[model samples]
Target: MAEAMPQTLLHEALQKHRAGDLVGAAPLYQQVLKLSPRHPDALHLLGFLLHQAGQSAEGLKLVNAAVATAPLHTDFRGNQARILLHLGREAEADKAFRAALIATPANPDALRDLAITRRDSGQVVAAAKLHARLLCLTPADPATLLAHSGNLIDLGRHDAASALLRKCLLLAPALIEAANSFAFLQITIRDLDLARDWFRRTLAAQPLYAAPHSGLAEVCFFENDLEACLRHSERALELTPDDPQIHVRHGFRLLAAGHVREGWQEFEWRLKRADRIRREGLPPRWQGEPLAGKRILVCAEEGVGDELLYASMIPDLIAAGASVVIECAPRLLSVFRRSFPGCAVHAYKREGDRFRPVHRYDWLPKDPPVDYAIDAGSLPSILRPDVASYAHQRPYLTADAERVAQMRDRLAALPPGPKLGFCWRSKEVAPFRNLYYTGLSDWRSLLTDPAIQVVSMQYGRGWREEIAAAQKAFGARLHVLEGVDMTDDFEDILALGVAVDAIVCPSTTLVWVGAGLGRPVMEFGVEPHFELMGTGKHPGFPTVRVFTRSLAQSWEAVTGAITDAVRTL
Candidate 1:
């Protein structure tokens, strides 16, 4: 009779629970538990209800007790694992999930949850294998397919990821995540048109989704449609105001379109991004103000090319009556020291070193004090706010005079021809920016010219083979200044800029170096950088003449044009 009473109460509680009356079921479950204290069904039901009601801590305890009571119940074990996962006890949850899988092999729910847990814990390979198993078990499952595709993408198996995503879309065309993933893959491969189409389709299907708008913004950016880029980016920001990437994109688009004021404000958000170095324990950032006696530290950020470009503003900062201290890349320490003799120049301290550099103001020997610290990239927003504000621009950086003289002498010793310095490619290569790279083989027309002595200014390794191959293939004598190490010797490179008649290259640091030294530089690129936005001329360097590849043509056309231009020069 007692067992029958408990069974009746248990049945009633389960009915109430299934009917979504958690409150009505709770007391009944307690009554059944009182009648039959070891009732696993009552315990598990009450625990699940408690968890749903936000009493997760107590609910987890009850679920654990139920699982103990019904030791071999796979469902109860899975429920316990889920409760543990909800409480962020991932390790404990993983153990519980494993136990559930052991109780019933090929348990779909357990496998799925375990896979997700593995992925979140950064055990990606294990997660991928588990997802693959889930796929085998439920081949037509769109959600599992999408999850597996994400793992493949993380593993950089994009083709496999795309295949799975395609299957997911075919199964369920309105699957927004699958569509977005497909678009992202297209973007990765630099298929801008396809990415655009996918993003548009996604937006049409789900207008309120902010991700597609941001993806469209990126597509517009790479296509050089600044207005469209800004519009999409702004819309994305409106949808999700806290997204840092959207802000950064909007900032760059604004800068490219010559809207400096708002652009800088948005660009400031880069400080919050994960990739950038966060300068901890720094004084407040400087906002353009008169600093008669204030000491300021200008920290270098980004690549050498960016540092060189931003170094143009140091002179302006100096002119504002601030005693400047610069922390730069070790390679640029000598060059910057030479360029700005009045300011203290130091190489950025290497991270994780036992000994740290004593970063004190040049004027104050006793105290390590500075009124403000700022990123070098931020100076342009304050100093050159508009295209017109760059009026005072000229060669701000100068090479070592002795190195210049030596390079000039060395160049004079070479067989007489119009000396042209050229770089065929940038050191950094990505699918999106690979359009800017002109292969050495593509430069045969220019290299074959007997009237021009093409100097190899392309730095980094693997240049020698390309140079040798080009020389043999074209049967032309391209001059490489034998002793001048083009890789690390920036000062000598600057001297070589003076030595050469004209500097011709794709958008690289060498072009900036040549331009900064007041040399005649012809910049060849597919897309204009932000500095070359308005006038197709570098705002800071009047000597640089940009020759960009037309939308309809490739680098061959660019090289042909360069060949003609060089001949004329």
Candidate 2:
């Protein structure tokens, strides 16, 4: 009867706890604990109630004591791990969860806790394995399926992740998270129509959900609907004011739409992204203030193409009485050094040991005290804030005269015809980016012109076969300069730009390089970049003309137009 009394009290406490009456449950649990001091159930239950009531310190002690009393008890250990995780004691929680798993290897609660803890601790592989184990235990759990799919995405197994998401949606069609994940994957793959459909479906499932609206905004931005992009982005911000990514996206949209001031303000959110480089021991960022004698470091932020594009503003910076230092990609060091003789040029040291270089500003000189540092991309916002400000448009980059003469001589030696440079592809192969390129076959119409001697300015490996195949297929002469390596030598490329009568290509770095060197370039693409936002004409280079493919038109039509233009040239 003595033990029976404690058991009866414990049963009542559990009933109240399950019924969401923590106030009624706590005292009954205390009564049971007083009768049976070392009872794990009573101790764990009371601790959980205390923790839920915002008394985590005392509750953690109680739960630890419960685990100590019943060391091998799976429930006790699992509860301890959960409480530890809740209190942000990740290391302790990880240990406790491992212990619980040792006690019962297939304990679902223990497995889930451990999996989440592993993922949070950056043990993604282990977390994914744990999640897989848990899914095997409960195959139809939508939450676990979603979590596993997220791990798959982190592992770059997107197709597998996509399959899992589809399965999750099938199991629970109303699952908004599954729908959102699927839609986001679609966006990553540049399946804009499918992405739009799924994002709308997610919105229908949960009207107030902010993420789908943000997704729609990105879709609209890529589709060249600036007003719609802004509308969706604003709505998303209204729904969730604190999302930094959405703010960054909104900034790009605004900048692309020619709302420079507002866009620049929003673009500041790029600093908040995890991938943004944080200069540990540098002075604060520059805020477009007058610098009479201050030394400013213009740090390169994004791609090599962006660095070259933004380098146009350096002479203006030098003219403004600030001594400028350019931190740029290693490949651009020579080009920038020669172009901007007044400023110091340093190659940004690649960050990691990975094969593909990830460039960051780790080479800033310490002795020369920098008054301020600014992102290169941010210069447009400060220096050229409106369409009128872009009037200082002249060829800022000059090719090496010797390289120019060399390339010019080589081109002159070719069979008597117009020397035309062409690049059909870009290095970036993301699904959305693929939309920017035309297949080599699509260039046949342009290549078939016997009056033109097509020079292969296409860079990267495996291009020789493409050029040969095109020549064979079209029965036309497309000449590739034998000695000049176009990929590594930016100076030679600039010289080639000078040598060629004109350049014909899709929007790529070659277009920027050609335009920067004052070569007449005809650029074709679907989306309008910020450089060509207000007018179809490039703001920085008058020699470059943009031809955008209409949404309804096929690549054939765009190429056909180019063919006509080439014939006229």
Using TM-score as the measure, the top candidate is: 2
lDDT of 2 by residue, 536-564 (tens): 67776888877777443568877787777
Work out candidate 2's RMSD over C-alphas: 5.1
RMSD of 1: 6.4
Q: Output the number of the lDDT-best candidate.
A: 2
lDDT of 1 by residue, 349-404 (tens): 54521112223223322354788888887887777778788878778787889988
Estimate the overall C-alpha local distance difference test score of candidate 1.
0.81
Name model 2 segments beyond 4 Å from true.
1-141, 144-161, 184-194, 219-224, 352-363, 366-368, 461-477
